[model samples]
Target: MAEEDEGPQKAVADPETYRESLDAWMKMQMPAAEDLRVHAVDMPRATGFSNETVFFSATWSQAGEQTTHRYVARIEPPDGGLFPIQTRECEISCELQHRIMSAIKDSGVAPIPELLPFEPDTGVLGRPFFVMEFIEGLVPADVPRYTQAGFLVDDATPADRERMVRDAVETMGALAGLDWRTMGLDWLDVKAKGQPSLQDQIELYRDYVDRELSGREHPILSASLDWLDANAPSAPVGISWGDSRLGNMIWKNYRCASVCDWEAVSLCPPEADIGWFVMFDRMSYDDFDVPRLEGFPTREEQVAIWEAKSGRTVGHTIDYWEIFGAMRFDAIMIKLGDRMARAGIVPAEPGISIDNGTTDGLGRLLERQGVSL
Candidate 1:
């Protein structure tokens, strides 16, 4: 929750100003006015932060008829972090989107919307923003505060929920199995200096955690770091979705249409992803009484499928990352909670929701270590 004592370049751009910039980008990108027609452009009321995402309706009128279109726009935030949750810059995010969609093009992976266009320069949208064809239908698991309100109360049928979960696992498995090294990305430079290998990634994240939370100390976090260092998997890192979880993949018609927010897709061990996934499910203690998810895959079934394809085994060290994952999410939640209290950006949360979420996550982590939360 503490502000960075040391500094990195920070930029703050207002939403309204950002939108105007994006609209200008649309105009420029589609300079052929006759061919391009935009009907309506709108953003969500309560903005979400996965990226500076906004929704817009585009109507294309060519020659005689008008065709309606909808799109989701995402841009980099004004303030950047040394090693923050936003993950990658526009370059990596765009590249991942391209590659993943390419892989799933002909498959039953549910057609992902195509990227209409993007501009890397901050000149447009005050930062990089990309527009993609927006797919219709409910996300299935959402706050359901807006366009998706009706489905929120549906009490999803068992068959539909199972299909959605299976689809998610299949899509992710396909992605992790992808051969990303052939993308000529060996020449692609990562901003983090030491990223020639997985060890570099592990060490970098560990160091960042230590430095960022210099004043705060968690014994489990320290233990997790040591455990990972001592047991680095020798297998070459594959495409690991840095933030692979059910929440990230939304269901459309009992299928996952969008596998998104690829700002963190990178080379990492298959176990790295499975461990993260397993721990995420474990963190939720996702047994019963969960609102958004009715019932989903057990960690065993998901791991079995991934293992059958990858031929890898998960061990003790990964248990640490799972704990660390909880720690990472916990830290974020704590920061959000603090901001809610200090700045009153949303509702000055009296620290209720995450208080229990963190407690549960910690309990899961401690259980892994044969301790109690």
Candidate 2:
């Protein structure tokens, strides 16, 4: 039998415990009221990235009435699957999602599940984590897996899939539509945020690849870099969903409920987002999937879509960033595979509970998923 979860506990073996830990913190954040009802907010299970994830039911009492609800918390990895190892005091990579989501919530682009709190107290749980609203609708990824086998829900129809896809794309446009400068996070120190250029991105990945892959040689790797260098996209970078793949987008009712896992958000080539969608969504490549550019629509098609949606002629050649982003995924995963003692490994979280669940049963760093719902 699957292990039963206990009070605001931790799942260190997994990453999702951030949710539980977050609730624990929320209990403190919200002032207890005679009119408020609160009970054991336990997390069950949810899946994304290499973190330990669990969902739970909540009941808070108010004015002799009970308020029941649900929400999700993202904690540090109890296992593995975090990537792009950096030797620094703080990581821009790790905190990317937290910062951007906070901004998006402020910007009013798309809906975001309300954030409760984030904290890292080993004494409380086991590691660092945050909490957010639990989206109760049919999260796109689960419907197919939990609902059927080999039915290929992915093949249901382009219309349903289109809603999902449109949401993903439009979310990008919605975000890109924002003015970063007005947002106040527009310009960050290069040292802190790293250079927001194709070259800076390339060098960062190159270093990541050399250290993680032990400098493993792949012809495609060099070809990809050479291609990006040769055919670099035009400059003045806006926000790019560094990992804007299908899985990163959270869908509900055939439309995007939230664009999440902002773990890869960065200021790089605007086309980078479009390119990443092509590599991961269109080409059916996992993080490691690299595609031949000739078969896909011309760079013009992508620019047209972005320009039409974002209302700006941002980039006409994102093929470079697409190739770069795909390679980045491969390099990160290769590093993850190296670090994991088990198949899944994640960053260290203080006091986070570790889930010793059976392999991939909890969907930690899933190897197979699709762009369509």
Clashing residue pairs in all predictions, respectively, total: 2, 35
lDDT of 2 by residue, 1-373 (tens): 3434433334454334444544455567666633333344455453434554445545666677767767665666544335543223225332445667888889888777787655555455564566677775444343233123222143435456545555666677777776666776643323455445666677776776566545455444444445556666566667776667556656666677776776656556566777666655433423223342222333355446666787756553454455566666655655454444333444333101122221111122222221111
The regions of model 1 sitting more than 4 angstroms off are 1-23, 33-39, 45-49, 81-111, 140-153, 187-197, 286-295, 309-321, 327-342, 345-356, 370-373
Model 1 per-residue lDDT tens digits across residues 1-373: 3544533323224556545655566667666544554445565543223356677665555668766667787655433311233234323354345444544453443356777655566545545556777876555343432113345336566667567667766666666565545543442224444245566556656655565445665545555556556655566666666667666765667777777666555555545666666666664445333444455557677776666655565544556556645644544554445444555565643453245456465555666666532
lDDT for residue 25 in candidate 1, whole number 0-100: 62
> How far is 200's C-alpha from truth in model 1 (Å)?
2.3
List lDDT for all candidates, in order: 0.55, 0.53
Q: What C-alpha lDDT, on a 0 to 100 scale, does residue 314 get in candidate 1?
A: 52
TM-score of each: 0.74, 0.71
Tell me how far the alpha carbon of residue 195 in candidate 1 is from the true structure, in angstroms, after superposition. 8.1
User: What are the RMSD figures for all models against the true structure?
Assistant: 6.0, 9.8
